[model samples]
Target: MLGAVFVGINAWLPLDPLKFCISHTDCKLVILDAERAEKLEPIVDELYAEQKVIGMLVVNAQEGKGQWRRMEIFDKALQNSAAGSPPLEEESVLAEDEALIMFTSGTTGLPKGVLSTQRQFLTNVLNTQVGPRRAILRRGEDLTPPPAGPQKGALIAVPLFHVTGLTSYSMLATMAGMKIVMMRKWIPAEAVKLIRSENVTLAGGVPAMVSDLLDSSLVGHPLEGLFFGGSPASELLASQAQVAFPTARLSQAYGLTETNSVAVGIAGEDYMMRPGSTGLACPVNDMVIVADDGRVASHGEIGEIYLRGPNVMKGYYRDPDATSQVMTTDGWLKTGDVGTMDEEGFLFVKDRIKDIIIRGGENIPSLLVENALYEDARVREAAAVGVPDRRLGELVAAVVSLKAQYGGKVTESSLIESVRKSLPPFAVPVMILIQEKPFELTPSGKIIKSQLRKLAREHWELRQKNIPKSARANL
Candidate 1:
């Protein structure tokens, strides 16, 4: 029900984080599901006293019940709504008018609300359309008639709160008149069923969701395209996806909340050609890799990626200080992702600059170790981090989950040896911990490396305690 026409300025906030944003933004109205109404009732007084909210609109409410009994029920309000109102007329909206306020994932700190203007949103929608348009052009000289019946549907498995689902997929779908099969919550098995039942032609999300779908027993579904964004995906995973969904065009996009959505996309044959790259900059955007010295990095040199385009957000809502930190005076938004661009302009994301592991004054890219571990046939997932070490200042450590078939067969020492073969001595992980469970992921499908680092440190400390004094001294 979070459609483009009805909601002029859409802001999605989870219940737990709702108060902070509402209070900060001085939100005057709230519309929510009736089931969640009770949770907010207790805080309504506090919110009202602070002038954060003035009224509530409950959806899916019983005919008559609860504190919101007098409030306007959203479903009832919509029934015969157009007939009751005067003829709808399009209102003039400026390009600079705020259209959305999306909050960052806050993986490293507090979530910052990003303000996006109508221009940014519309520009992103047009830029994304170029991908499919290019695909159709590449189809080449076909006289075949368009498929009969309704437009093809796309399965939306990601949360609408994230830019990938909302700006990139949902908005684009709306503009193209594509039917959307939205999932209230992501369930791999249910997703497969929807793909077949609804005849979904396009399906995309984080790599984790795609991995789950490929691993599931669903096959021969009518999925024609699969694209993912919001995180880095290994080449190994992309290659595996090609085999699993042979008929589908696989793509990997790169973008962030500050950029509205996708600023770069690679799909179909181009994706196959550049296996690990995040593709070229979108038609409407300009991308540059800047080194630490504030100079533009040459092709093949890793540096912080910067993007400049109309698709870039206006600024952080009510946080000019935070906005100034990330956005350069020249208008480029620093993406904080360390990456390189080949001569062909294909971008390769190495890892986040903050994610690099420093071991004894030597900087080691955690992605390198993770990619090395992924090369092993037995490893299903891997994360590398630096744990405090008395002698080395910080030591490289890895946590991995093996493929079910190789669960007991694969050992921690063996995985470390595998990485050693592919990396330098200093880059090789000193400790390797096998996870019995999967790694925690953000809504965007990125692994929570902070949690993994904490787990690795705990495991290492426990191992040190278990070692004999003589053995510890030798180590």
Candidate 2:
């Protein structure tokens, strides 16, 4: 069995553990709860028959009698002479450097395999020192660290499987000797309760989580700090966060799985000064570089982001060619994000390169269109995509979910008109579809544009098929 400690901190704890084992053959599966043990019986029985059940380590079994009993069964099953080998000590497992395979949120596609070495894990942990610590030091205040206690630790309500939740809060908490208070899932009330009860100095989440907390009036007090990222937060949301939590420092960061949470963050005064910038690059890892073409775009000019430093993965597992596509020989990884850097080195993300819509010869940024739709009072959430257009090659299309309070106040034509007024005529969406429900999102709360594109294509095809005979003939 592989020597690895599985930090079980996700809502789908048992399923993740199963997937972790399946992805990495060497790692011994550690089930933290008896609830997990109960769920694993059928699967374990199947694996046992296949001679795959090697060893077991069940944590916190004493908390529940049934759980303890279930763990004992698992323990005994593995301990039987026929079961092969005994489980090794936790230190023995930690001694060797092993592959840690983590699953992506499967937001845009099937959760891709993310593999990092134990060295990479330590590198990423060390990388965290560059951002928050530097920010604190630059404050020119007293340099003493916060007193060790429950309140000093970050309050992490999100699950640990996610890169942001895991790195920003969980792993960071561990490094700081901070206690983690987790919920089965995010409940606004429960989050508030924990913040107050535990005196959680820091809380981390994406924009949607913050929006949910703000949507309800239950969060009535200021927090120590509110850290958000994984998706863009509009100025409206940023302002609301400030209004709601006057004393708390509000921040946002940008990073991807390949970087292992090499985050770029700007908060407090920086957030107020430049609401949309992703702040300066984290010093722990040199995460910022501009592509050759975009290098000369000037300050605030759009460019493809290139990342360099220890934070980048060695390469994609078992796909050297695919890995080579993103990694540079000189140690840079093309991030595929279109962004701009200010004279002061603040990074502002414009849109994703893949999501850019080329309508005729014009490059229409889908994020701008999405942001426009989001600004509409009637729109609750929106996603913009490029759909095939025989005449223009590609046309702008938007899918939007309306706010319940709007009561069908806005129509497709009205939304089109709004875009026309704000943007160039060619940039206006050629098609707009209203959705009663919000778009499906990843664990990080990023809208699944790929899914939305599929749905949009189907919707447009159906609409074309239903066109009147006269209209079709004219076309």
lDDT against true structure, model 1 = 0.74
lDDT of 1 at 441: 84
Model 1 is weakest, by summed lDDT over 10 consecutive residues, at 1-10
Q: Candidate 1: which pairs clash?
A: none
Give the range of the ten consecutive residues with the poorest summed lDDT in model 2.
Answer: 466-475
lDDT of each: 0.74, 0.64
The residue-level lDDT of candidate 2 at 447 comes to: 82
Candidate 2's C-alpha lDDT? 0.64
lDDT of 1 by residue, 1-475 (tens): 2222212222333344566766666666777766557656667777778865776788777733544633567766677575597666666677887777876633332456888888997788877765555555566735344677767888887767677888888977787677899998778889988887887888867666777777787655557788866565667778888888888888778888899888987877778777788888888899999998989999999899999999998888888988898998989999878999999889998866567664533445677678779989988888888886643346888888777787567676778888776676777898887865567789999988788887777777877789522111100
